[model samples]
Target: MLPVEIKSILEKRAKDGWVPEHEAKEILKIAGVPLPKSAFAATRQQALEKAEEIGFPVAAKVVSVKIVHKSDVGGVEINIKDEKSLEKVWERFEKLEAFEGMVIDAMTPGMELFLGARDDEQFGPVVLLGLGGTAVEIYQDIAIRMAPLEKEDVLSMVRELKGARLITGYRGKPSVNLDALAKAVIAFSRLAMDMAGAFSSIDINPLMATPDGCAAVDARIIL
Candidate 1:
């Protein structure tokens, strides 16, 4: 079942027809997907407190319903290790249009992966997996499957990727936990099935795949 808070966020954002990143993360958490510790703050003091609570060396992004490409608008800051830097980033984000708040979250380290779903007239909901990061567009290495995937389907999809070798340890890099990744994929597929027809598209980009598990570090839901 969808959490009441998540349902409320979806409903409110539906008026605008899109769920902001922070709210999208909250909804994904319900699917048992891992996420970095995070908090939302609407004021400078609140941002500082939340940042402190979340710890040093964190990242911050603007939480605006109107702002889609946050980085383009200078609404994102990373490697924030002290109150001074956090304060500065907060001030910068406050300058953006429709500035709602800031999301302060831990800096999760790992190899990036992508997971997404979109409503398809013929397929119902289609799930996508790929090598994620700023280069996802450049690389264009991805695989797809229909929603509600079984374990075998998920495994096959992963192996089909051009970057599949990366997950099994490439060169000196350690292999990521495939079991954990599989679980995350299954959870995302279930979420797609459950929320089918409600969203035009859902994107979980750069799902940080660490030695332990994958974390949905960023997300978006278009209604």
Candidate 2:
């Protein structure tokens, strides 16, 4: 969950129309995200400079309050190898209708999943896990349960889905860190309760699962 201190950073950046390098960091500073170093910069120029300083092949994304699907609206730009790509992508990004602002940071490789939290009328805050990307809409293979579910429950959620086999080192791919994903799910559960006043729902699609850990690639918060 976002600490009271870093929550201010979230408010500060988004208010100034600057997207924080890591929204999750702002939301998870107290508990801490696995890789906070990758989180930095609040604007395209800021991110570009940081990327140049960090070196090539970084990623950039629009931090829009209005657009729930940033990719569909053409607000996401990735594998940005150099300053030249940033220049081109930035221009295209500016033209996006839902562009409130953007975030830029170092790129990391991993598998992807959808993690969501919402305050269900009957259940209060509930967490969801599923196969993400184009398959999320097509397959609808989801598992849902009440907030503060146990680690075993997280495993149960994964096992319950037919796509759960993907995380089990499928097709010669390495198995993912389901434990870390569970922690993130728990963290978001805490966040839902903590920020109940500021938000009504959240969707963290494409939560990247890497050898080191999980990272949220995209997220949406509805107030």
What's the lDDT for all of these models? 0.86, 0.68
Model 1 accuracy (lDDT, Cα): 0.86
TM-score versus the correct structure, for each prediction = 0.96, 0.82
Each prediction's RMSD over C-alphas, in Å, is 1.3, 3.5
Off by over 4 Å in 1: 1-3
Q: Residue 120 lDDT in model 2?
A: 73
**lDDT of candidate 2 over 43-130, digit per residue (tens):** 6677667777766787777665555566787777778888988878877777776555566656767877888777777767788888
TM-score, structure 2 vs. true: 0.82
User: Where is model 2 poorest over a 10-residue stretch in terms of lDDT?
Assistant: 31-40
CA displacement after TM-score superposition, residue 23 of candidate 2 (Å): 4.4
